[model samples]
Target chain A: MTILASLLKRDLGRFLPGTSSGGTMLPLLFFLAVAMLYPFAVGPNPTLLAATGGGVIWVAALLAAILPLDRLLASDVHEGFFDQWALRGISEEVVVAVRLLAHWLSFGPFIMLAALPASALVGIDGETLRIVELGLLAGTPGLAAIGIIIAAITVGLRSGGAALSGLLVIPLAVPLLIFGAGALSTGGDGGLALTAAISLLLVAIAPFAGGAAIRAAREG
Target chain B: MEPFRLAARDIACRRGDRLLFARLSLALEAGQALQVSGANGIGKSSLIRILAGLARPFDGTVERAGTIGLLDERPALDNDQPLGKALSFWTALDREAAPLEQLGIASLLDVPVRYLSTGQRKRAALARLIGQQADIWLLDEPLNGLDVDAVKLCEELVAQHCAGGGIAVIASHQRFDLPGMSTLSLAEYAL
Candidate 1:
């Protein structure tokens, strides 16, 4: 627990005003702006909007959420933060756990917010919006977990771009997108149920995937 | 706190296509320091990684004791990170000097480390060692950028760490003088 606390603290501690982007708040606002622009850009077609709203919102959330991941571990892995975590003699599994959670908190919320305004473009109604939002809230952590594992693998490489992450990450995340949209399409209760099952599955998969990813990245 | 004793036999590391060092055998005991002297391209840092447990060598077993503190020439700081928060990466360190007090870098602690001068960043890395409470010190050109006083402070710290049964292994091109430190020139052992 001490190690977990310390690792968690260290992972989240990067957010201390001085450590990372002091202007991080701006990104959230940027997402909001982007989402709002979608409705106008796509033309307000209600039927077209509702059918696709769920998928568009999820993709946009993922796109925005994934933007910073490569950079996230890029800095720390090179800085020996990952190495120190390795040498701390703590379980690397726990470090991965802490890091994924922190990344979700930092990057995932903005994705949700980014998708919120864009939801209108797809013709999502009020209740659907709530379901999608709630579904997103529950499901985005899985995206972060998957994204982080992918990022950790690529961070040490000289060329760790979105292209590279796509190669390894797509297969693992299909369920997240599928069930994520399922929850919103079917209703909150349905989405909630799927999110629960998927979240549990993610917990099982995260440790192994994250562990391998960290090791592979560091070896590079 | 014998600077963690290192027990290694037949250790060899291959950095890439080339073998950095092979069939290497050495035992570093408490209160001892060994300088891993070699040319720049010979995998000095790679050896440090193996010792620090960050990398596993192609062959050989190594047993290291105590917390190992590594100070590479680069300091491994995130330029975007401030001095104080960046310091957290050195989890092995426990604080001994306030960021501002030791290197006159207190004001810059909040500044992105990338924006700082190379010398300033180096100081922050060294200061992190003071915080780590590490008994096994692996310094890869720790003297890169520092005034005479800071070098002396480092020497004193290493000496103290050794005096407390700690150990230090350093790799450097510059001349570093210390009493009773054993020297193993990688040149002499090169294949």
Candidate 2:
């Protein structure tokens, strides 16, 4: 529908890297910074790096996802954009769903691409790199979903909200991080499938949970 | 322009442990305007939200027919974007042309929303309300941060909207003079 398209266009413009609304590049840069820093922090033990690089990448990806959570839903609720959309008969679920897509588009693919250079920085093998990319592809949607839900819940909190959202994400993201990184060590399709399944379930539940959170925020 | 109605039945509103107002009720048919006035913190804004269906009343029910539009203290525009782009975002969605020139903000389109003065932001919000073309308009403190001329312009805009068969419910402590518009003092309903 035109309304959905308009909302998506606005959300993407706000969220896409390098185009205002707090430039999503910060998260991408933070992700690569972690990868770039790991080798030096632990010394250049290629086997040690390779052995632990996959888990490091997963952890970095999870933290990087948190960087944008503060901006995701708070501004809209504060600025009354959500109320306006609701007036137009656009349900909060639809807006949250569109925002979920835009959030993923803004960082998910870029993170996957950045994983190439990150893999090199962390001393990961070619096969491990492929699995890492695949795992991120399967898991970042779950991350985005969790990000939106947390953002909605914390939209009402004034200060300490950003920190709280980051802390909250770590616990909820444990499942995705576990299965995604587990695939690298296990060298099995089972972990990837489980990661994708969790991702699918989170993505499905995010819009409704986030929608309710926004409405609750309106009351407070 | 469709036949529209907004009615609240013995609504009670509470914020936290304090009851702001109770046994408040009003009704408006098409082409009518009502102004809600009260001291600060008297729940005028809460009643507007309840009428707009954004917040549930602690008691009673609100029944309405036709779409609702609300203009509050927040402009609802992207702060980082130019005024033109931000308004265009709504224009594209609402598919209604706003009277930007009449609102005295046509020249301000190139300015970023954050740079706009308070009066200009209020004008821009009025433009957005026009673009929405909703049958019911719930304006909370619409005259805040406006000059005398801008205040008159706002009153005229609401007057014209109602003249065109829309409903306007303005919640403001400031004086809003409109011919045929009734005023509700919230203090009467306060506990």
Candidate 3:
């Protein structure tokens, strides 16, 4: 239990926004940039903006999640953190699990919080904003899981891994995107429940898959 | 601290399509030190990793009864963090304070790890290893990047560790002087 706490504390320090890792502000700024630019690109049509804004936010959130994926597990593996942890009898699964939580905490809630201002920029109504917020809350854990799994797979790549990881996440994230963004259109709790279920499934499997990837990377 | 043992039998290591070494075997009881010496690409570091259980052998078995501590090329410190904060992360996990003064990194605690010289970074890694206090030490090229004084200090530290009934396995082409240290040449086992 103490080990988990220390791991969480260290991961939070490395991953938290505004710290030396530069984690906090970049994704929020990027999400807002996407929101702020959509109106300019499409011209000022209130109905059009409101109708498409929720989808745009979903896309923006997915892209923002990608921004931190490259840094997620690559740095620690390169710096020998995983090797040290293995020597201490700490499983890679545990480390990756803690990292998944830290990765989500670093950006998931913040992105949800940023949605209010973003909704204003994109002209989403209060009702739509509520759905968007809930969808994101249920969906971001899946995003974080996708991010960590891809990060582990790509950590051993020599070059272009950051770009590759971003590419890999999009296809895997489509289910989350469909269910999450579909909630806004359908106005049903079923979509939200499915989104949450997908998030739960991804969250459950990420640590084991990611742990195996890291251990495999050690061989190479 | 308790009675410790590490032994490898009929080990074969293959990297990619190439076999680095084959049919290598060795054993160490408590208070013993072994130095693995060979030229570059001779599988010295590979041997150390195999013993540390971080890498799987192409064929064979490794048996051990003790915790393993490893020091390698990477210091494992967060480059952006101050030295003190970086080491403290491990200290907190290990539940032991690092011997910063003994490692001569006390004055360097405030510096970002990236700004430190190679030798300073090596010393910081040593402090982390000391804090771990494991029964077996697997050090890969521990003498690299150290000044003359630091090298001597490292040798002394290893000697002290062995004297305290801990085991040391060092893999380096560079000479590492320690009393009662046996040397293994990987060239003889190269396939």
Candidate 4:
């Protein structure tokens, strides 16, 4: 438990925005920029904004998840933190699990908060805004999971890996986007429940998959 | 001071398609040290990795009886952090206070690690290694960027570690002065 706590502390300190490790507000800023720009692009028709705004938020959230992907595992793997942790008998799986949690915590709640103003900008109804908040809560964990997995797999690719990771995540994250955004249109609990289930599955598999990916990167 | 052992049996390492070395083996008991030397690209680092259990040999096996600590090219300290805070992360985990003054890095604690020179970073890494207090130390090119005094300090540190019943396997092309330390030239095992 102490080990986990210490690891969590280190990971959070490195990842949380405004920490000494240079964790940026880039993702949050990008997310809001998307919401802010959508109205101008579509000329601010209230009915049109209300109808399509939810999907725009979903797309923005997904894109925001990509902003931090490059830094997630690459720096740690390249800089030998993983090697030292391995030497100490801290399994890659444990580190990846802690990292996944940190990754989620860094962007998840903040994006949920950002969504409030985003909903206002996009002219979403109160009931729809509530669903968007709930959907983000259910869907962002899966986004974080997908981000970590791609980051670990691409950790060895050096220069172009960041762009490639973003591309890789889009395809993998289609399900979460569909279900989470699909809930807003269908006005149903079933979509949110399915989104949460998918998130749970991805979260469960991310640590093992990411652990193996990094170990392979190390040996290769 | 606990009993520790590191041994490799008929281990062969293949990087990509080429075999770097083959039919190599060595063993170290407590209070022993070995230095692996070779030309660049001759597999000294691979052999250290094999022994450290970080990479698998193409053939044969490695056996160990203690915690392993590795210091390679990467210092592993967080680049954006002050040296003190960066080192503290590990000291906190290892639960052992490093002798920063002895490593000549006590005064460098406030410097962010990215601004540190090669020698300072090397010394900081050494502090982390000493704090780890692992039974076996696998060092790859420990003296690459050190000055005369730092080089001598590194040699003395390794000697003290061995004298205290710890094991050290150093992979370096440069001279490493440690009495009674056997040298293994990887060229002899190169295929």
Candidate 5:
């Protein structure tokens, strides 16, 4: 219990400052604005708009999360937090989980903010919007898991990470985007219900993969 | 009862294709301390990491006791956090140390740690060690950047930990000046 609280506090403490950090707010604000402007940017075609909004918003969310990934263990790596954490017998897996949870909190809501109004603009019906939210609910935590490891390994690397990380994660994430968008595309009888269910299944793999990746990076 | 500990024989560490240490062995009873001393690049820090379990030993074993505190060369601090909160995260520190006070950064406690100088950063970490009353202290070059007074405070803490029957393993090229505290040379531990 204390671990969980400390983990949450630590992550937020590290991540929240970026909300006000120099020049970062612009990209996220632009992301939010771009989500709002998609129909306008691509033309106000409702069917096309709704069809793409879910994917666009979720993708932006995944990207926004990337901004903080480099810092996940970067500071700790520099300062020896990871070593101390390990020495204390607090499992790295637990610390990694906590970091991801905090990442989820940091990124999850912005996803909703990006999608909520975009749904209205894209003309997604209430039901489909609900499914979009449901998919996000099931999905964003998975993003944190994926982010935890990818960020840890790549945080300290120089150059080519954008491409490397994208290549590595996109293939894995394509499924998520597919189902996530599919759920929002399903208007009634919710083909999305199945998508959402599959999301749960996929999300389970994230923590394990994330845990292993983080451990390997730290130990390796 | 003294938090019985066991490590596999040989503490091996190889990073970026360079082997830091191999087949290092050491043990400590409660109230003991061992300073892991070696020439730079010989893997004293790496040995500390392996002992702390943050790095895998490429060769031998690392027996560990209860709730070890591994101090890194740089103090792990979240600069964005308030002085109190960052210190609290370690769970080994006592609140009385007051994240900012022990480090003489009390005025800056509410401010970001990123703004502090090198010496201030070291002092802040020292305060945290005072706060965390753990069973073992594994410090890496702990005296770096500390002023004389701060060093005294740190020495006092180490003395306190050992006298309390806790254990400490410090890695440094310089002398820490505590009488009877032994040095575990990594020269033999290296491959």
Candidate 6:
């Protein structure tokens, strides 16, 4: 529908790379920074690096997902965008759903692209790199979902919300982390499927949860 | 442009543990305007929001028969974007061009919204509201940051809107002059 398209276009503009509030490659850069620092901290131990690099990438991706949470829904809610939408007979669910897709598009693919060089920096092998990429592909949607749900919940908080959202995402993201990073160790497609399944579930539920959170925030 | 109506009955608003007001009621038919006036924290904005259906009344129901437009403290414009681009977003959604020149924001369209003065931002919000062209307008403190000329322009716009058979409910402590505009002092219903 045209409504959804317009909403997506606006969201992409606000959140896409290189925009002022959009995080503009900060998450990707942060992921690379984490990857680039691991080798130095571990003193160039190839075996140790290879063994832990995939997990490190997963952790970094999780953190990177949180980087944009503060901007995800807070600014719109604060500026009364949600209220305006509500008045127009547009449901919060639709807005949050569009936002979830936009949030994923803004960071998910870029993080996946950055993982190649990140693998090189962290000394992950070709086999591990393939699994890491695939696992991330399966997991990032869930990460984006977690970020949005938490962002909605924390949008009404004045102080410490960014930090609080980050903290809240960690525990909720553990399932994705376990399944995604587990794929690296197991070297099997089964873990990837499970990660994808979890991602699907999270994606399915994010819109409703986020929608309720936004409404509750308005009430508060 | 469709026939519009807004009605609230026995509406009560509670914020946190405190009751702001109780047993408030009003009705607006087409071509009618109401100004909600009260001191700060007297639920003027809350009353406007309750009528707009953005917030739930603690103990009543609101019935509305047309599309609603709300203007509040926030302009709902992207602060980082140029004013033209920001208004374009709403214009695209509303499928109508904003009256930028009429709102006196045509010259400042290239400026980032963050760099705009409060009055400029308010005018931009007015443009957005105009573009929406909703049948019912819920304006909360719409005169807060406008200059003398802008305030008069705002009154004229509202008057024109009401003359066109649209309904407007304005909530502000500042006196808003309009012919045949009914005023509601919220203090009467304060608990």
TM-scores of all predicted structures: 0.86, 0.98, 0.98, 0.99, 0.83, 0.98
Worst 10 residues of 3 chain B by lDDT: B1-10
Off by over 4 Å in 4: none
lDDT of 2 by residue, B112-176 (tens): 99999999999999999999999999999999999999999999999999999999999999999
Model 2, DockQ value? 0.82
Ranking by DockQ: 3, 2, 4, 6, 5, 1
Residue A210 of model 5, lDDT score: 57
The sequence of per-residue lDDT tens digits that candidate 6 reaches over residues B1-191 is 45689999999999889999999989999999999999999999889888988789999889999999999999999998899999998888899998888888899988999999999999999999999999999999999999999999999999999999999999999989999999999999999
Model 1 ranges with Cα > 4 A deviation: A1-10, A13-34, A110-116, A120-122, A166-171, A184-192, B1-3, B76-78, B88-111
lDDT tens readout by residue for model 1, B29-146: 8889888788887778888888888888889988987777777865766566676777665542343443457566677767777787767877787777767667788898987877
TM-score of chain A of each: 0.80, 0.98, 0.98, 0.99, 0.79, 0.97
- Cα lDDT tens digits for candidate 4, A1-220: 7789988998899889878678888899999999999999999699999999999999999999999998899999889999999999899999999999999999999999999999999999999999999999999999999999999999999899999999999999999999999999999999999999999999999999999999999899
Interface RMSD of each: 3.4, 1.2, 1.0, 0.9, 3.4, 1.3
Scored by lDDT, model 1 comes in at 0.71
**Candidate 3 local lDDT, A1-220, one digit each (tens):** 9899999988898888887655569899999999999999998999999999999999999999999888899988999999999999899999999999999999999999999999999999999999999999999999999999999999898689999999999999999999999999998988899999999999999999999999999988
Shift in Å, residue B146, candidate 2? 1.0
Q: Count the clashes in each prediction.
A: 16, 0, 1, 0, 15, 0
Q: Kindly report the fnat of each predicted structure, to 2 decimals.
A: 0.26, 0.87, 0.82, 0.76, 0.74, 0.74
Query: In lDDT terms, how accurate is model 3?
Result: 0.94
Per-residue lDDT of A6-50 in model 1, one digit per residue for the tens? 666666756422344542554455455665666678788777677
Which candidate number maximizes DockQ? 3
Error of 6 at B133 (Å): 0.6
